[model samples]
Target: MQDKTPLTPRFSYKSDRLKPLRAFCQTVRLGSVSRAAEALFVSQPAITLQLQALEREMGVGLFERSGRRLTPTREGQLLYELAQPLVEGLDGLESVFKDKVAGLDAGELNIAANSSTILYLLPRIVEHFRAEHPDVRLTLHNAITADGTDLLRADAVDLAVGSMMDVPADLSYAPIYRFEPLLITPPDHPLATKTKLELADISRYGLILPPKRQITYRLVDLVFQQHRVPYTVALEVGGWEVIKQYVAMGMGVSIVSSICLTDADRGRLATRSLKEWFPSRSYGVIVRKGKYLSPQARAFVELIQPDLFTRRDYDDSGHSER
Candidate 1:
């Protein structure tokens, strides 16, 4: 009689842990066990079993049934946030490994920034990054905060360099540079000569400001509303340079962040600190949560702040393998 060969299992204990987690992540993402099974090309029963096993291991009910679809429980949602990245990183381990080996030699790094940030903040950083990594293609999209946030959510840009006042939960804003708010006017403007300025004093004059849709307008309005002070906007300009020119041309007085001030600006415009009344503005790196910074992206971010994105939360996780 021929000796029967013992069959080896397809998945090991280590792989067993990985499979269930992948299954769980997929079901949570796709919102259907059958859809996840089809996407992963696993049998429906196997997907259900894997999900059941995961729920047992996690010691919690992972899903709340909504008709045929499923929504993750609170605990399950949190677990998905943490595990999705891990699963993605492990799945793309081969390509990420290859990218690391390839280095930043010839990859592209896309960054989003407003005109103000590109004009005032990123020039030196961009110059140095270009000098160090000449082979890496760098493109900066001119985007306002809302547009930049949209680009980040769409993964159209790797990161953004700007200031954020109210950071949303899905994005991370780390302000590396701080600048005091300033009141700017032509050197001959009345308020420019006042030794001490008050919010009421500033409110008396028409202000030239960015369009009301911008954060600066929102912040200015917020401060005014909080203090019960009334104000007016003489002009709704788009760019800082235009605002400065309008102020310089004696169109109106305005408030701006000191980040835009240069020696040339100081020569033409009288600037006074409004920090006492207004909060300081910050400029820094803004990245989407769970982003895996590419080599080129990482290098540029490090130039901005050596210790930036080193937090435990910014763990280097790559994109979905599937």
Candidate 2:
């Protein structure tokens, strides 16, 4: 069998090898040496040695080991937080240099977004981009709010559009638009007759909500937690499409972003503003830290004209909801 013993713990040296820093950040984020090693594409021993050298240089223990897992010390946590953006900037710098040398013009753009963007934002942008660069292909992927950012980091997509909260270090974001969440129900649903609601009254019905970890769900939970309201979740689905369909079928009422609505859906589902609910859902364009945006991709991003809801061209563009 291969040797599994850990090598001697040597503290980090005062050298400028960024390898150790990268390893440290990954380990802190993932809480596992093996996982960090795999991410960095280095041997476990190499990663360990670098960390040891780094610890020696810093003169403080960075991590506390407990059986199989590793947790960052307070200092380590602080350092990891500071280093993430710096590392991402460095990665972006390197990519810019490589792109400068390659002399490439047209390339593909991979965009991942929630159905809301697919419905409200993409059509006009796609049309404008195609008119400018007919040769370049623009592909957009759709996911629930939770999975959008992960898909960007995993290289499953080049850019993502969704909630900007806790965006990863390896990604850059540009705010595109903002809107508020609304309570929606089938036109004849009990809540539709009313123009507004109190928390207790809304909570009385079975709720169709996004999973607790999802961004929208967090917002909803925060409101409930702050108001000390009790509510029952009848179903937790991942996507807005599913939620809308269920609400349309009279299964349950849903709290959804206003961007999820369309003219066709307006009559089918009655939307009521939640005055106490958070008034904004801000979405952005997220790209990998070091990836070069092709000329076409650059153009696409530039054409994403941000405007207030009253000024939106949603009616004329006819975007099909995904």
Candidate 3:
């Protein structure tokens, strides 16, 4: 019989070799080498070199440059789809394993949330999280939900905490709190005194709303259209505080999330619940589908909802291949 000794493996099992795979995954996800470099905390030239090495080894180009953009080629797309989860799984393995086996002694948890959420919603939750896991470094990226969603997709942030009206298929939202929509007006506005308020009545007055580009504006617009009520936007402002100030100054009436209404706010403005007219706004934790939550992230999520991770079918095994 002929000798049946196995030929040498093409790729060595050195851990550093996997760096190129990670570099390729991030570059494709962000669609630019520079952004990928920033995300990976490496130099742009380093990223480029890694991609070049990967292409040379695979014998196929992965990206096509068009102006400032890098579009993945067909081969690149196939590689990305196959490699992304594997890279993420490997990168997150240590954190996942330690989190499952040892108590939360140390880890980094990055979160994305808007200024409003950081201001109003997360203070207590953050305080508790800090007290519980003093060793875990927690970093919050201030971004609106729309921008936060993009950050989640890129794996830039571990998760997002905010309100989402339209959850993309690739992400999951678990609401921890629900706040009624409120019609905020100065104490003397005509609609404030009416014991029973109607949608048409509110539509009659000019409204101070968030910028038309925001999801809040879209929700407001859709509600008005559904009621066949013609509404006027008096001012397109950005922040809830600024909009509230505008309403108090009598610029226009506005609808806002009741979570923004505090005891201090009650003294300055009159709020009538719009639950009769509009759906309650929900605030929740948003995460990418199939993401492996680090122990620190899982701890914070559990603080929000005791069984949220389990209900979502998260893999809790310390050595899970997934």
Candidate 4:
């Protein structure tokens, strides 16, 4: 009854203990103390000390180390699950407020895109954005489409610009540009003389393709399989430029996105449209479902699609008729 007067808790909003919480969350998010230190602009020892202090205060081990990787324990996982969103919200609050007040003059925008998109599509967009908002920090993470989706899910990137064949349930994709698939061969190759090209015709020669693990390779494989065509992989290169280089070198022909084709390539290579043989690919910006876009991200997205933010046509599944 006397205790009903109520007790004041020792913890307060301005407590220094929250620093350790931030360190813990960053460590968990980055999956290593070194990475967390780099992101936080602190020393590795400082991050380690913060984690140790947090573990001591909580009386539990948070992370287990294996080789260079730091894996969260059950306690760590639970703590992260409960603490991450709050920490991010609090940390981003100042930027959000300033962005609201300043009208997109400041803050950071992180983008994930593959090498091809970065090479072909982003230069002009980035130039435009830079001209408009010089104060905003821009970071481009070079990741393939699959890895880009992973980055989007992890909140590592603000937005991703790439080609996605299958959209995941938790993500939204809005295509801004479409490119046809093309069969590229060296200027002197036998296929260069043929205007009416078919899958069977392309299959007769060795193909310089992206790695078999990539979606492009899978799409190529599926198209050839569906047509009952047998193709040989002479070399499995990584980038479109490399594939194009090899193709131009007369090593093998390649099926590549027309987005990668430019005026410079016209002189070195022979290109024939494969639109009938392969579906056109859409390169677009992908974002997480229910994600709150920052002012910078919103501005960039608007550049991609003027009505992307204003339009309510997108449903929970992230699909729209447009």
TM-score of each: 0.77, 0.73, 0.73, 0.69
Which scores higher on lDDT, 1 or 4? Answer: 1
Against the correct fold, how does model 2 do in TM-score?
Answer: 0.73
lDDT of 3 by residue, 138-166 (tens): 99999888999999997789889999888
Better of 2 and 3 by lDDT: 3
lDDT of 2 by residue, 241-319 (tens): 8899999999999888887787879768998888565657787666654444544445566577534112321211211
Which candidate leads the pack in TM-score? 1
Kindly report which residue stretches of model 1 are placed more than 4 angstroms away from their true locations once superposed: 1-73, 90-94, 309-322
Score candidate 4 by lDDT.
Answer: 0.81
Each model's lDDT comes to 0.84, 0.72, 0.83, 0.81
Which of the two candidates, 1 or 3, achieves a greater TM-score against the reference?
1
Residue 6's lDDT in candidate 3 = 97
Clashes per candidate (backbone, < 3 Å): 0, 8, 0, 0
Q: Model 1 — TM-score against the truth?
A: 0.77
Best first by lDDT, ranked: 1, 3, 4, 2
Q: Give per-model CA RMSD.
A: 6.4, 9.4, 5.3, 6.9
TM-score, model 3 to reference = 0.73
Residue 101 shift from truth in candidate 3, angstroms: 7.3
